[model samples]
Target: MWLDPFLSELQAGDGLPVLDLGCGAGNNALYLTERGVPVVACDLSEEALKLVSERVPEVRTLVLNLLEPLPFGDGTAPAIVADLSLHYFHWADTERIVAELRRVLKPGGLLLCRVNSIRDTEYGAGQGTELEPGLYESGGRIKRFFERDQTEALFANWTIEALEENVLLRYEKPKRAWMVAARRDWA
Candidate 1:
C-alpha cells in the first residue's frame, strides 16, 4: 500500500484514532488496524460500513457525508486518510471540504490522499460534460480531476510533504492519480 512510508508518522498521534474519511470497504482502515493502529472508518454508504464492520469488528464505523461539515472537533484528529475520495465535487465544494479536513486535524497532523488526475483518461478524465477546468459530470456523477498546479493551489495553505502523479495497477486497468501527503502546520 502507498501508506507504508508514513506508518511511523501516522502512529505518532499519541494513540488517537485515525479518521479514514470516505472509507469505502475499509481497505486502508483494515491495513492500519492490522498494524495495531486504532482507526475510525467513515463512509457515506451504510453497506460499505457494514462490510467493514464485519471484516474488522474492532474498527469503529461512522456514516459520513462529505458535503456537510465533519463531525470532528478542531485540532482533534492526528491523522486522516482520504484515499481516493476527494474528487467527487464541484470546485468550491472541494475547497470547502478540504478546509474542513484541515480544521479537524491537529497541528502537524497528516492528510494523506489520492485523487483522480487530469491525465486519467482510462477512468473518465474527459469523458463527460465539462463543469469547470477539471470538473466534469457524467451519468449524473460529478468528478473533479486535478492538475499539478491545481492540486498545489488547493493545498496552498498547508505544508505539502509529498506530491506525485503515479499509476495504480490494483484495478483491471491502470489508474492514474495524484498521491498527496500534506501537513496541517497551524492550529
Candidate 2:
C-alpha cells in the first residue's frame, strides 16, 4: 500500500503536512496517524470528519470539498494521499483540482492516488451514459475513468513514478482501479 512509501519518507515531527484529500471515513487517516505520521485529513462530510476525530483523536480533520481550492498554504504539502477520490469530476474541474494540488505541494512532493479505470466493467463501465471521452453518468453521479494514456496525459508534466491498472475487490465488488504515484518535479 501507500503507507510503506509514505511512512518511509516521513517521520513524527516532519514540518510538511501529509494531506489526505477526500479522506472518507478516515481509513487512510487512521492508518497514517496510527503509524505516527502527522496528517491533515479533509473530507466533504462532517460525519466523516467526526469519524476521523473519533477514530484518531490526534488527526487534524476538516470538512473540505475537493472541487474548490484546497485550504492550505502554497507549497506546504510534502505528501498527499487521494485514494479513489480523484474521479467524479468533469475535465475542467479535474484540471483545477490537479492544479491546486500541484500548487500546494512542494517540489519533489508526492501525490499517490487510486482512480477508476475504464476497464472496470463489473461496476458500470459500459452501462453508464458517456458524458465525455472518459467520463460517465451513473445513478445521477458523474465519474471519470482513466486509461493508461489518459493518466499519462493528465499529469503529463509530473514525474510519474508508477502507474498500473488492476482489478481488486472493494466493498465486496470487483473494482477496476489504477494506482498512481506521481511527484512534483519543480518548485
Candidate 3:
C-alpha cells in the first residue's frame, strides 16, 4: 500500500480519526484499522460503504460526493487518504475538491493520495475524447491524468512531503500512478 511508508508518522500524532476519502471497499481503511487507527470512510457509493461497514464494523461510513463541499468542520481531520479517487473529475472540479480537502485538514495534517499518471496507458491515459490537456472522458466518466508539473501545481498551496510515480499491479494489468503526500501547513 502507498500509505505504508507514512504509517509511523501518522501514528505519531494525536489520535484523531483519519478521513478516508473515496474509500472504495475500505482497502486503505481496513489497513489503518488493523494497525489500531480510527477511520471514517467516505465514498460516493452506498453499496461500497456497505461493503466497508460489513468488513470492518468499527469503521464509520458516510456517502459523500467530492464535487460538493465536505460535511466536516474546518481543520478537523488530522489525516486523509484518497486512493485513486481524485482523478475522476474535470480540472475545475478537481481543484475545488482538493481545496475542500485542504479546508477540512488540520494545519500540518497530511493528505496521502494516489492519482493517475500521464503514462498510465494500461488503464486508459490517452484514450477517448480529451476534455482538457490531461483530462479525458471515456465510458461516460471523466479521468484526469497528472504530469509532474500538474501534481506540483495541484498541491502548490501545501507542503509536499513526497511525490513519486509508481506502477501498481493490483489490477489485471499494470496501473501507473503518482503517489503524493502533501501536508496542510496553513489554516
Best by TM-score: 1
Reference-based TM-score, model 3? 0.97
- Top-down lDDT ranking: 1, 3, 2
- Candidate closest to the true structure, highest lDDT: 1
lDDT of each: 0.94, 0.84, 0.93
lDDT of 2 by residue, 17-41 (tens): 6999989988888887777778998
Winner on lDDT (1 vs 3): 1
Local accuracy of candidate 1 as per-residue lDDT tens digits, 1-187 = 8999999887777999999999998899999999889999999999999999999999999999999999999999999999999999988999999999999999899999999999999999988999999998999998888999999999999999999999999889999999999999975
Measured against the true structure, the TM-scores of the candidates, in listed sequence, are 0.98, 0.93, 0.97
TM-score of 2: 0.93
Error of 3 at 164 (Å): 0.1
The regions of model 3 sitting more than 4 angstroms off are: none
Worst 10 residues of 3 by lDDT: 8-17
